[model samples]
Target: MRYHFLSLVQIFLLTVTTPVWAAEQIVLNYKVFRESLSVEEISRFAQTGELSSSLKINFALARQNPKAVRQYLTQPVKVNPVFLDRVLNTPLGNVILDQISQVIHTPSQKADRQALRAALVLSARQDSQITLIEIFKNYPTSEVEVDGDRLESAYRQLRRLQTNIENLMGV
Candidate 1:
């Protein structure tokens, strides 16, 4: 009986903890990608006449030569709530999709939030949706409906994309 009880306890713990761990990893990936990108052009133009910052300037110079911008966009930067109900079910899903899309897009690529949101809405995979929903839950909010049916959709293409970013972060 004791052995059976221990086994049951272990199974319960694993089942409970697995979701939390998975949720945390998804959130981390979302954060790494979000922090890596910024609206620097707006800030730079506000501060200086140049539309781009020194980073962009350097990137251009490097492009003239041959080096990756990974060194610039990614840096040794040291890195929420419980709204994990239904992310896209509410209006917040649209916001979440846009942010993830922005992360997926090339830094220099000209894309608007709406376009990114639309793309992800159309092509996002399961894991990507799960990751986005996990990231969205950390946001503060009011009463929101949870829609399990819709979030089931997946941006399978993003499966590799998220993995690649997490791998890049070495996290």
Candidate 2:
């Protein structure tokens, strides 16, 4: 009877703690193909004033890179660039960027930036609709709904592209 009671306690403990342990084990493993971005690249990109085309392509590539990294990490991970950008553009972004900059200047933050950029891209590619919803929830209430909606639509489109890629890879 004592052995049976002890076994029941052990099972109960495992059931209670397993989920918490599992949740903490879920870490965001970030990787970057383009690990470095120079001031020259930023300045040139900015100066060229091809913001629309450049952002479009960069955003697309960012989506692709993260999935590859996630597969390498062997975990179910999602990357959303829109969420990343929105987060970065917020006070949270400022704090993170500031810390990163203090450790290294903007140009030097290339690795961190690339890692985060890739993560966001991957999230968008994986599940953009859910990502956008999450981003919208995090967004400051002061933001215009129309702007948020537009961004959401963009994320959805990106998600569709990501789905196509997954289908091609048979992942």
Can you give the lDDT of residue 54 in candidate 2? 39
Tell me the deviation in Å of residue 105 in model 2.
20
* TM-score of candidate 2 on Cα atoms, chains taken together: 0.21
* The candidate that achieves the highest TM-score relative to the unseen native structure: 2
Cα deviation at 131, candidate 2, in Å, is 1.1
Provide the overall lDDT of each model, using Cα atoms, as 2-decimal numbers. 0.31, 0.35
Model 2 lDDT per residue over 1-171, tens place: 355355888987554333221111111111332332222332333345333443345446555342332222222224344554555556655554344323222222344443333333433444542333222222222121212112333344434544544554466
lDDT of 2 at 46: 35
lDDT of each residue in 27-127, candidate 1, tens digit only: 11121121121233322332343434544543344332112222111211111011222333356545554544444332333443443433333222322
- Model 2 steric clash pairs: 78-123, 79-122, 79-123, 79-124, 80-120, 80-123, 80-124, 81-120
